[model samples]
Target chain A: MSAALAVEGLTVGYAGAPVLDGLALAVAPGEVVALLGANGAGKTTLLRALSGLTAPRAGRVLLDGADLSDLSVEDRARRGLAQVPEGRSVVTELTVDENLHLGALWCHPGRAARRVAVARTYDLFEPLARRRSSLGHQLSGGERQMLALGRALLARPRVLLLDEPSLGLAPRVVSQLMGVLRATARETGLTVLLAEQNVTSALSIADRGVVLSLGAVVVDAPAAELADDPALRHAYLGF
Target chain B: MDRLVFLLATGLARGLVVALFALSLVIVWRAARLVNFAQAAVATVAVFAAFAVTGATGSFWAGLAAALLTGAAVNAAVERGLVRRVPQGSPLPGMIVAIGLVMVLQSALGIAFGPRHRPMAAPFDERPFVVGGVPLLSPYDLFVLTVALALVGLLAWLFNGTTLGLQLRASAAAPEVSRLLGVRVPRMVTLGWALSGAVAALAALLLVPTELGLNAHSADLLFVHAFTVAVLGGLDSPTGALIGGVLVGVLVSLVTGYLGAGVAPLAVLALLTLVLLVRPAGIFAAAQVRAA
Candidate 1:
């Protein structure tokens, strides 16, 4: 199958200094690729660049061989690229249902379609469904992550970029989230590029691993090999 | 007893006009998170436009429509061309720019209209309707009250019941997240400004005829009350604007009736300070948990 997402010679930075440079990576359709990196390793920057949140200083991003270098973040989202940023970024003042409603706005779904999508999301994340009327601030961290994921799902994106989905969740919650990710990939053939600091758990479900060090790919290999490599783990991941 | 009832009723009607002005401030705040100091200037310009139109066409309704359109256009222009350029976050620059706009707009109106109180006729009779020898409400007062209520209701419906409104609320709350969700945040901000302008125009149109006349400074007094009302209600909450506006209206009316017109401003300032001290977020601010 053709690569769903491709990046070449990507350079990104803030205030005239490059954070990510000459970054190249590709993911096949239906693949769950864990983007492993330590702090300041350009993981978040890479995802932000791909999702059009951050403009690349130089390089091209291709989704299904279509160049998306010139699109706005919202335009990219409409074109089936969605990102769940760190901190769960829920509109804290809005009700859980309202936040979900915002997700369908990209598609401009009909009332019936919106209702169906929301109901399906509720089914996937029962806790969110239970607190449908609760304001965004009222939800637990796990529920917020679920709500964010569900929101991304409602957009029916082809590729989902998740930035540190396991940041603050409990171990059990992270495992549950990984299971959901696997199930979603299996059912929908959704391509996922997850950036995470939780190395062990991230490698458990990721199909392949792409590790970044100092903004360039250090190791791009199958998940098992990357996890088994003691030297690479010690050098980059520090355990 | 009859005089007291009459004063209270008139005060309530006056308050509705202030409520509309407060609502305008609330709309802009919700959308762009700015106080929009130029709101009175925009309203004054709209009133002058209405006056010019009414003078030429001899149609008050047509003039009112012109005012509404002018308000929307001016507000949209300000948001698109000026306010949006001030950069997001930290409302101080936007406020400073708006204050500058207020000065520019008011001065322009003063130069164009000669800074005199020019009278515009109200569509309905100004004489109060009487019941059992009690003056309850004038036809003009009722008209103002009705128009304000209808406008507020429409705004409530627009905000709570429509997809566009949902997008607006989301856009304001988390613009980046909303952008990620595919919302056109800039467009929503413009829409918010337009809505605020229209409401401000309506409040100005209704109140100017009752004032000394249609002049550049006609909206100044109304704005002070409206600003107080907007603060008394949390800047972000619409429901707060409504209740706070009416409360201010009643307080002002009672103070004017019993303590003389001179004491009304002091009474309002005192009430505002007390509300600020007691609940810094305002009575209807949902951001905080409601006290029992």
Candidate 2:
């Protein structure tokens, strides 16, 4: 099977210092890959680079065999690459309904189709339906995360890059989010690259885990294997 | 009593024009996060286009269309050619560049059209309609009111009811996030500039006939007054611009009528200061400041 998303010799830097140096990885279709790392392990940078937010110093990001180096962020998104960026990604001024509608702006051309997609998202995330008219800032952390996920899913993306979705949430909420992610990936056959700090929860849903340290991958193994290895977890994941 | 009524009526008409222009500023600010200092000069350039077209075609309507199109095209060109090139890490550089643009545009207009004020005749009759034994809005004033209100309503609909508006609002509020969601944010920003330019041109087109006619500097005062209105309304609020425009308009009219023409600017300045002191964000500012 071909890789749904692939990165080759990816090197992203700010000013002079590289954040993601000589990184290479691949995720097959319908696979969930947890990107585990410590605080400065370049997990966020890799996601940003993949999503076309951060320009890679030297590398190729292939989305379904197409080179994404020249594409702008919106163009990349239109090609079914979506990113749920770290921290409060929602437009705080917009309502939950508007935010979801925005997600379907390019993909769903017909107004009726857009409305149906939004309604479907609301059904999938019941909390969002209850607060359809509420502003983005009005939602709780868990609700905000759900809204972010719902918004991204509305894009019907081929590959989803999520940055720290479980941040600032309770453990139960994190698990619930993980379960939804796992179910969604399985049901939709959606490829995912999840950048996370929460090791145990992330490993729970991930088919494989790729650990990074100082801009390079340190461990690339099965999720269960990484989860069970205490020394590996302590050495890299900081759990 | 009759004088007060006339002043109030005239003030309302002028206020609507100011509101329309201020709303233009609000639009550009929301979309690009930059206060376009050259808006007045850009509008003046459109007015010049309208002037030339009206003079050539002998039709005010043709001129009106010319103004709207020229304004939109020029503003879009400026955004694409100049404003987009500047460092966007802060608002100050864009503003300074805009200020420079203002100087260049005004100087260019002065050279092209000369310093003389060329009279652009109003499409409608200037004679006021008498109602209840009192003189009220002239046909021209009524015309201004109709156009301004119609444009405002159209813009309000565009921003609140349409898909493009949603994308624009999303682009304005969170540009990076909007981009990731598949919104062509740069295009939205350019569209914003185009829309603002058209509106500003229309406002200037309406106001010039009532003032000392068209000149290179015709929109300078209008820009000042409209800027005050935008700040008074809160840079981000369209409703604020509408209300603030009328309030400032009435205050200016009353001050000019009772005090002197010179005192009008001072009154606007004072009103702006008071609004700033009382509510730094403007009267209708959003409850939460968007994270930059």
Candidate 3:
């Protein structure tokens, strides 16, 4: 079967210096891939480029064997590519319910369908349900992450890209988040490319681990092998 | 007491128009993050289109419909063709482009239509209704009031009750996140401009019949007062636009009624300055500033 998301010769940069230089990777459908690296490892850039937020210098991104070169960010999203961006992704001015409704906007056209999707999300994220009327800024860090994840999930995307979800969250919160992601992936067969600095938590849920060093993938191995190899973890992930 | 009542009544009618125009500014600001300096010029063009339609068909309703559609179409075109090309990292480039557009549109209008004011007739009677020997709202003023209230109500329902409104709000607040979730952010911005243009056109249409007439600069004073109202109510809040428009309207009416017409502009300036001093964000501004 074709890879769900394929990146070839992907080079991206800022002000002339390439952040991601000639990177190539492929993620199979329904596979949970942990993109592990330290800060400035081009993980964020890769996700952004794949989602069409950042333009690639000399490369192509393919979604299910379809080239996404000319597609706009929103067009990429409409084609089942969803990203939960790092740091305060929720629209802080809007209430939690409003944020979720936005997620279901294009995916679920009918009002009834949208309502059902929103209600289901609220049920899954109990904290969000309790604070339905509350604005995004009012939520705690973990709650904000939950809201962001919940909002992205409402899109019913085929491939979900997440950036630094475990950043600045408590251990239990991270575990809870990872658990929800794992459960959702298992139930729905959702494909995920999760970028993370929290190696242990990411590996716990990811089926495969792709370690990056200075923008190119240094190791593409099973999640179990990467978790067991302490040398690989310390060198690339800095754990 | 009778004079006060008359002034209040007159001010209420005038304020509704100002409120409507200011609400347009608020809509554009929320959607595009820039005040459209050419709004009055754009609306004037639509009113001119209404004039042509009214002249050809001899139907005021046809003219009204023409104005609304033309306003929305022209504003959307401006956003897509001109405003979208400029760098949007800061508000300055967009504001400068809008100001330039105002000059271009006004010059083109003057060249085409000449510098003469055209008399546009109102659909309803202008004679005030008397209640117990007290002069009150006229049929025309009542019409304005009803239309203003209904439009406001409709807009409120659109933004708060519909999925499209949710996308507009989300895109404005967090464009990147909205895009990630499949919301068409640029299209939403264009729609915002269209909505603002239609509202501005309606305000100009209402005011022209009561003013000197429809000229290239007909909506100039209205734009000034509406801008002030938008600022007084906080550019981000629709509720602020409504309240601020009314407040500015009444204040201008009372100042013109008691003092002189010359002093009304000064009073508006003074109110704007005072509001800026007290609350730079406007009275109805949210407590927390939106994250950039």
Highest-scoring model, DockQ: 2
Best by TM-score: 2
RMSD to true structure for each model, in Å = 2.5, 1.2, 1.4
Candidate 2 lDDT tens digits, A11-116: 9986467898899999999999999999999999999899888888899999999999999999999999989999879889999999999898888889999999
How many steric overlaps does candidate 1 have? 0
Q: What lDDT tens digits, residue by residue, belong to model 1 across residues A109-200?
A: 68888888888889998888789999988889998998888899889899999999998899999999989988998899999999999988
Query: Which sections of candidate 3 miss by over 4 Å?
Result: A14-16, B289-292
Give the clashing residue pairs of candidate 1, or none. Answer: none
TM-score, predicted candidate 3 vs. hidden true structure? 0.98
CAPRI quality band, candidate 3: medium
lDDT at position A117, candidate 2: 94
lDDT of 1 by residue, B1-292 (tens): 9989988898899999999999999999988888999999999899888988998999999899999999999999999999989867678999999999999998888888786788888999888999999988999999999999999889989888889989988887888889888998889999999989999999999988777898888998899999989988888888888888888888888899999999999998888788889987777777643110
Candidate 2 structure lDDT: 0.93
Positional deviation of residue A140's Cα in model 2 after best superposition, in angstroms: 1.0
User: What TM-score number comes out for model 1?
Assistant: 0.96
Give fnat for candidates 1, 2 and onward, in order: 0.69, 0.83, 0.81
